[model samples]
Target: MSGIEELDEDRLGALAHKLDRPLVLIGLMGTGKSTIGRRIAGMLGLDFVDADDEIVHASQRSISEIFDEFGEDYFREGERRVIARLMTENKGVIATGGGAFVNDETRALILKQGIAIWLDCDIDTLVERTSRRNTRPLLKQGGPREILTRLKEERSGAYSRAQVHVVTGDLPHHETAMQVLEALEKWL
Candidate 1:
């Protein structure tokens, strides 16, 4: 659980020095993208912006509310707009929604502007992590394993397309963040 445990420190440090802007965190619901993105941004002394949060701000409604009132399609379109705006801003860490990467336009937009890090985690771990929260609309039914299975099948390919993939099931948030930075350091 040590900070940045999955990555070689020397390589990440070197990459951190050369970075021109904040990195982007992309992955499934419970992969710790928001938690770890904030930590990584703090470590690098950069701002952190969660695209979902931005979406909420612009719409003046929570994600759950959006899903409840406007349905998934509207929420998703709003997400695309929020992500597009976030990408255009100055350097700042960004954490995208789970569904955002699945959209062709959103995926292409992220790939073009930022270093996308996929916080890969096993289905069990994702289910466990997400179980503690109620903000997820897709997960409100049936069982966790079933939901995970569907999500994995639907988004695995898009997630795999990330510039850097960091496994995070057994690691703490700090360690995961470090690993992401480390892998990205060498990658960039």
Candidate 2:
């Protein structure tokens, strides 16, 4: 599949069957990991699991609530456990929390159990994309730019460790999803 025209459900399902393994997306917040992961899952006829959503489900509270109540270290631990659970499951697309890959233990867990795709995005695009969303606890602590810098400083290396990397600069959501699908085509 080379373009939008080739990304019909049949072709996508075939690609999913070809990979037959969980595909994990690693990237900063608002880089479209969750959005693209869901698209990929839909195209492939597979389930979609967002690491943050899983953590929320497991904790019975939102991520900000977790951090506000228990703290980031506590939230990170919860993220680690939730990611570990999702990585070991059947074929699906798992969109990891931005910080999940930064943890050595969680990074190792994902690398061992699944293929990691770094959803690359420029800082400008990220700021624009994330600005519309208010649910991000980290960015709320300070200026969005400063928070992004801190996150990039800390998590860039782990994102680099991914088996595949896709640069997603200002692309449409479906196009971004198709790019991820095309990247996995070779490995599949």
Candidate 3:
């Protein structure tokens, strides 16, 4: 199993079967958490959940609307609740919002209930990917590169507490997912 295309299905299945808890992906925005998480869940025969999507569903509003109507504090509180509920209900691949892991309570909950994996990436890649969309709340305040740089610095310590760390580059999503699988193989 040198590469994703050459990976042995039986070996991959065996590795997935060995997992005892949910795999929670924590990272800055544009780190490919949602994209890679879905692939990992499919590979492992588990469910895939995006925390922000769940938050939107629960709130019945867009994240921007939630922020505008309720403020970030309100949104964070709701996010914490939604994550706790998700963590308690199922063992799967959970892609969290960028700020979710930065919150102490949410981070503690994730650590307690799941195997947290930090999908780290360089600032250039983050900026490039994030620039494709203008939906990010944090980026709305400033340039993507500047905002992402500050976020990386501020949240690096929190993200470092994850159980596994997978460095992502400007590669295909499957390649990054394969790296996560390799990290999980070592971690488990």
Candidate 4:
């Protein structure tokens, strides 16, 4: 078996038993929070939720449509409410929108209700990953690298407040998920 398979088989039970609270992943848009969060949740035998998806469901609108129709402030307020509700109702891995942790209220709620994990990735990795998609609203205003750099500067402090910090790179999603599990194990 491969190293990853061995890791997963060996660690799954221990990791699943260690989860006492929700795992909230915070990071930039292309940092693989959703992907890694799903992997982690699967390993831990828990459900995975994307906060953005929850917001879209609650609002009955696409995120882009919400931003276009109601403006960023309105969308952010809605996001905060959705995240808060999800935390109270669900217990599993939650991948938050890139800007969700930047909101102080949302951040506070995450801190109180879950163990936040920051998926730290370098700017080049973020740019390359994000370049694959054009649906990102913030990237429409500037180059992917530039926008990610600016966001990294603005949001790194907030992300640093997370209970666990796992640096991600151009690795397989499961590998990154393993890194998050390692960090969470240490934190727990």
Structural similarity to truth (TM-score) of each candidate: 0.90, 0.91, 0.96, 0.93
Candidate 2: clashing pairs of residues? none
Question: What local lDDT does model 1 show for residue 45?
Answer: 67
Q: What lDDT is obtained when candidate 3 is compared to the true structure?
A: 0.90
Could you arrange the candidates by TM-score from highest to lowest? 3, 4, 2, 1
Candidate 3 Cα deviation (angstroms), residue 50? 0.6
Q: After superposition, how far is residue 33 of candidate 3 from its true place, in Å?
A: 0.4
Structural RMSD, model 3: 1.4
Instruction: State the C-alpha lDDT per candidate.
Output: 0.82, 0.86, 0.90, 0.88
46 in model 1: Cα distance from truth in Å?
1.0
lDDT of 3 by residue, 21-95 (tens): 789999999999999999989987899999999999988999989988888999999999999999987788999
Cα deviation of 31, candidate 1, in Å: 0.4
Off by over 4 Å in 1: 1-14
Candidate 1, residues 11-116, lDDT tens digits: the string is: 5456667776557788889989899989888777678999988888888888999999999998888898888888888477899888998989988888888778
Clashes of 3: 0
Residues 129-175 of candidate 2 have per-residue lDDT tens digits of 89998999998799998889788888888799988888887878888
Which residue runs of candidate 2 sit more than 4 Å off their true CA positions? Answer: 1-11
Give the per-residue Cα lDDT of candidate 2 at 86: 81
Best by TM-score: 3
Residue 120 in candidate 3, Cα distance off native in Å: 0.5
- Misplaced by over 4 Å in model 4 are 1-10
